[model samples]
Target: MRTTDFDYFLPEECIAQRPAKPRDSSRLLVFNRDDDHVEHRIFHQLPDYLNANDVLVLNETRVIPARLKAQKIPGGGRAEVLLLHRLGDMTWEVMVGGGGLKPGKKLQIINGPQAQIREDLGGPRRVIVFSEAITPMLDRLGEMPLPPYIHTPLEENSEYQTTFARHPGSAAAPTAGLHFTPNTIAAIEDKGVRIAKITLHVGLDTFVPVREDDPNKHPIHSEWCHVPLDVVQAIKTAKEAGGKVVAAGTTTVRALETAAHTSSHQNIPEFEGPTSLYILPGFDFRVVDAMLTNFHLPRSTLLMMVSAFASKEQILQLYKMATIEGYRFYSFGDAMLIL
Candidate 1:
């Protein structure tokens, strides 16, 4: 399909600059696929729609403080680096924003160690080798890589992270999970809905829009993900009990579907690796029966994914309705539940 088909008009005021005060207080738009009905409610009321037999899968991948300020060693020009993936203890694949960041160029981190460009991976991507392991110093040297649309700075680093975040790797937070707080999760668990955790380290590519005329020609980047045996067992139990598999975000959908995609048998196996599964329209969904996600940008892969889960026309109409209803959009925005 044409990438232009996914494009829509979004007013600048609709973009959320800050998260909801209590996290769970954010608005939620629920769409029932069976009845073609819709309901607008608070995110804290999510448990009302969940059944006791359902399994809610959440992505526990934490967002890293990936953005770093630096200066050229010899010329002293300012630069910025965004860590995308860790290659080793002292090496990372990053996106550099500066001139002359080519191989062999040295840069001094603002308050961290020295780094050298090892290789250029075309465009803004480069392999950087640091003087020492930068992971430990990231807290002091790096800043959260918030989306460019979020003009207001976060009051705290944890503002961008989900309350259940554990394993640190993702460059961006799973916005759908961001709506959950301890109380919200407690209420869901108290309803007897099983909670399962998976991980898919989000990359910046998730926010990148498809530039190609045909979306099929877009190069989707692979993200590291894991679908553990426990999660597989949880899904099996939920399905056997006639329960739905409710994915927290598109990342969770990708991870679970990737596990199913790679399996040779009817059941999904434990998977741990990078997944490049693109959920275009007409894709056969084997795992997820419901989804909770944020309003994505127009022409974005995230939007395309939800379109695949539902239909492009329906999703577009819902988005337009949400806009008219004054629902916030993008990261740190309100959420939508599709079932």
Candidate 2:
């Protein structure tokens, strides 16, 4: 499919620059595929729509402060780097910005602290070797890498992360999880709905645009995910008890599905590794009965993945409804629950 096929008009003002005052105060657009129904609701009312016999699978991956400002060696030219992911012990992949800086050049974050560019693989990426541990260097200089479309500067650092964020590795937050507060989580549990957690450290690739006309032609970036056997057992038990496997975010869906794909039995084994699984339309879902996700960018792989899980035509119609209803869009925006 052409990238344009997924296009839609979004008012620039609808892009959320900051999160809603109270986290759960954000708007919620409920999409019920079972009956072809749509409802405009608030995020706090989410549990009211959900039954007790559901399992909410959430991604616990936390967003790290990855954006860094630096300077070129000797020339002292200004430069900025966004850490994508660690490649190895000393090598790291980064997205650099600012005017032309040739390959084999070195960038110093602070005076006398330089990272040598080992190679330039083209695009916004380069392989660099820092003077010391990549973590420590990032700890010293990195700022939170907010999405490009968000116009306002991030005033408070903590707002970029979810209230329940525990694992600090992802470049981006599993935004759907951001809507839930500790009280809301307890409310969901008080209703008898079970909660489970999985980890998929989201990378900068989550924001990479779909450049291919055919969605299948897009190469998905590999992300590390861990699905513990305990989560697998919880989900299996929930399913056995006639409960729905509801994923809190796309990352949770990916991790659970990847586990089911490689599981020896019907349950996922505890393991840690990388997954490049690109979930588009026509893909049979072995796990995940429903999804709770945020409004996605137009023509993004995220839109395609959800369209694949639900009905494409239904998603498109709902998106049009959302736009008409003046719903906020993108990360730090409102949410949709496809049930």
Candidate 3:
């Protein structure tokens, strides 16, 4: 329950600097919970391990170009902004970084395409006033806010999002879904494994560390999610047929599990709304039977959630193995499928 319990040593070199040449070429560390076994294989080999009755639930939320750096007018001081979420009617919850642009300061952002600080709650989260709707401005001025660890420049912003990215709301990609290539998804369908999509607009909260030692004491951030009726029916049908429900990412897992809470059946409930469920050890997984996820940062809630899916010791052991074997880590890194 202590935050330190999830800690592990990871060499700096193991943090992936960039994506693999062919996206699906990255390694897959498959963990079978039923037998407590691990298999190392390429990601493209995913279809070979799945079958017709299985259901693959994926998060289809798209990553927007959220980072925008603009110079303050008149004096030309610089300010960095990462748009968190649009609060509609021309308001936005923006994480802006700069000095002097305090509360009530009316500043021109980037040469007449202006904005004003209506409020500054401090520490990166702010409420801003954009002269016009944010959509047009973001379409022109924003850049994808890649994870801080990936220092290289992204010539194409699309690479930061998955190939199947559709809804443009998530600040971050549901990374486990990142490993799947177009061919890989096609192959999965070819094997008769039904693929379903859900939406969980990932936020900075998913990456925030557990500040409390006891997992139950930590607060979680709410994220907007939607689980469609079809995906629900498919999961229900699959379970009835004695097939497993495999979640593609933690985002999808959270969405599906949240929905299942309302179901008359034990594991698959129908749901739609915002969820702040912080999954950790001792949490009963009512819906998901298997999970596909990316390597997470040390002591992160994500790592702890995965630990809950398997045992904390098993998850930590795999992390050590991943580090020693030089498997890439974090958003653009390798993936693991816990079956």
**Which candidate number maximizes TM-score?**
1
TM-score for each model: 0.99, 0.95, 0.96
What is the Cα-based lDDT of residue 215 in candidate 1? 94
Distance from true location, Cα of 201 in model 2, Å: 1.1
Clashing pairs in 3: 260-269, 263-269
Give the count of colliding residue pairs in each prediction: 0, 0, 2
Tens-digit lDDT track for model 1 on 1-339? 899999999999999999999999999999987787999999999999999999999999999999999999998999999999999999999999999999999999998999999999999999999999999999998999999899999999999999999999999999899999999999999989999999999999998999999999999999999999999999999999999999999999999999999977878789999999999999999999999999999899999999999999999999999999999999999999999
Cα distance off (Å), candidate 2, residue 35: 0.8
| Candidate 3 global CA lDDT score | 0.85
Task: Tell me the lDDT of model 3 at 317.
Answer: 91
Query: What lDDT score is found at residue 136 in candidate 3?
Result: 66
Sliding window of 10 residues with minimal summed lDDT for model 2: 132-141
Model 3: per-residue Cα lDDT at residue 195: 94
Model 1 alpha-carbon drift over 4 Å, by segment: none
**Residue-level lDDT tens digits of model 3 in 1-339:** 699999888888888888886889999999888887888999999987787999999899999888877776557788887878788867888888787777675556553357787887767788988888766666677888888788988768777888988898888889998888899999999989999999999997777878888777888889999999889889988899988899998999889878876666774656788898878899888889999999998888899889999999999999889888779999889999999
Model 2, position 200, has a per-residue lDDT of 95
Instruction: Give candidate 3 regions above 4 Å deviation.
Output: 263-267
**Candidate order by decreasing TM-score:** 1, 3, 2
Considering lDDT, where higher is better, how would the candidates rank from best to worst?
1, 3, 2
